[model samples]
Target: MMKLDGVVAFSMTVEAGSISQAAQRLGLAKSVVSERLAELERTLGTTLIQRTTRKLSLTASGETFLPRARRILREAQEATAELAARSGKLSGPLRISAPVGFGVLHLGPALGRFLRDYPEIDLSLELDDSFVDAASGGFDAVLRHGAVGDGRLIARRLAHSRRLLVASPAYLERHGHPGTPGALEQHRALLYSNRTSDWRFTAPGQGWSVIRPRAALRVNNGLIMRDAAIEGLGIALLPSFFIHQALAAGTLVAIDLGVQAEGAELFLTYPKDHGAAAKIRAFGDSLRRSFGSPPYWERVEPAPRAAPI
Candidate 1:
């Protein structure tokens, strides 16, 4: 039988894309991680990784062995967690990924509460807007907005996401309100760097209208785009979570109410292998209970406007 230690070392190295990163995460010396990977390769009779100074890439044989090895390691870890859970103890590090803004605004607080509730579980979180590959990133789960395209990752619905087309009221008053999505083409737009500047709209008893508007400024962060909109730079399409206060205070108004976008969904995704892990299960349950029913964050009543500085 293959050695369990060697299998786990190999999986961690591949997932982290470097022996150094794996060693850091595993709290082992670089030499030890390298030794275990070499040992595993020798036992399997194939080289798993083509290591270079810049990055590590898997060989064909390594690619073939990857999924199975990950599954084996995951199952072993889950069994250990399950045994702990049977004793009313859920203990293990749970790594999570999320977009930077949301991670700071919402997830950070939630994780603090969860950690306090489950003292045995350790938590590590990474924040970025880029799409994360859970298997490669060593994440137990990732909080993602909109739908995920990867079929291998299992997605659990966490909340409903609404996208809004908004601009500062001053900007709207300066430039007349757009009556339809088509009218946006004539206005200055603030767009996200990662996505197209297309806005979709549907009115009651009307068909879909798609608009690909021009952008005056394109930025990578949602917060930046929202700031630009607040400063009267241009109109922006952002997740409703980001603009709740502005919309509620009437600082930023939704231009065409009936012609707004819909169908953007939110999910908490994880590798299919992590489904049975106790920490993952507990956190998922906590998240569902905290935000799933009626989605309190989304249901926030419009707050009164704050005095401008």
Candidate 2:
């Protein structure tokens, strides 16, 4: 095969007017550049450069070979750029699975931007509450909360889900706010079916404790939990992403129970064995950037505190 490394060295050395300048341009040592010129001349069976103390001059043979070497360098660069552009242009079937509530509520804008940037990406997004197996379900990536289980998969965390204990002004006014976790037993609890009656909480000084609130309503979806809380049905524990808006608008007040539950994290998981596909990486990066460090949803302004009934 015709080697292009020496060809590049020779072309740059000529164009740069000196070996040192050529090395600077090529990001290689001057000695390495000289060696390349020597090796290239050896391969061509001719002295391509007349090296001296003052400057470098091309031999008649070097002059004739110089044009061909420069042409070779251009071709090599064009070839590299073509392959790079092809790789940069990510396009393929990108199958993904996510929880229905999140996908519908928050993922719309992110998905829109991704589609605009990569129109060639044939996107297949399945919004379901259940955990979907990326390998068996033929999904390229899966958006999941909590823990990512499956040795076959590699996970990238998107954000930490901040759970909030919330109740509407009406509900608090009617039932009175519970000041302590233990006092929550007297209040109505709207539990998520995915969650248990045993809710865990902790504080910087208070340590960890489990609060088994009585469940008045249990549903499989977060929206139902949120809406029930909004409608003054009961106090609901929900993700900050789902209720930050209501909290900011004063439709719901964040109940500080003197402790906080550790939030489950959101993850973008892909098959570890399938190799990192361009489309999957692109989508994952987009989501991460959208979420940012603290996540855009968590940026809500602090809501007004509800007073005693």
Each prediction's whole-model lDDT (CA): 0.80, 0.82
Which segments of candidate 2 are over 4 A away from where they belong? 1-87
Per-residue lDDT over 21-62 for candidate 1, one digit per residue giving the tens place of the 0 to 100 score: 999999999999999989999999999999999999999999
Span of 10 residues, lowest total lDDT, candidate 1: 300-309
Cα-lDDT of candidate 2 = 0.82
Q: How many backbone clashes are present in model 1?
A: 0
Off by over 4 Å in 1: 1-88, 204-207, 303-309
TM-score of each: 0.71, 0.70
lDDT of 2 by residue, 1-309 (tens): 446888888989999999999999999999999898888888888888898999999999988988787666656654554454356665657788999888988898999888887787789899988768876777878898887778888888888778989999999999998988888888999998875767789988777898888888998898888999999999988888889789888898888877898797998888764433456667877887777778877888867674665
Best candidate, TM-score: 1
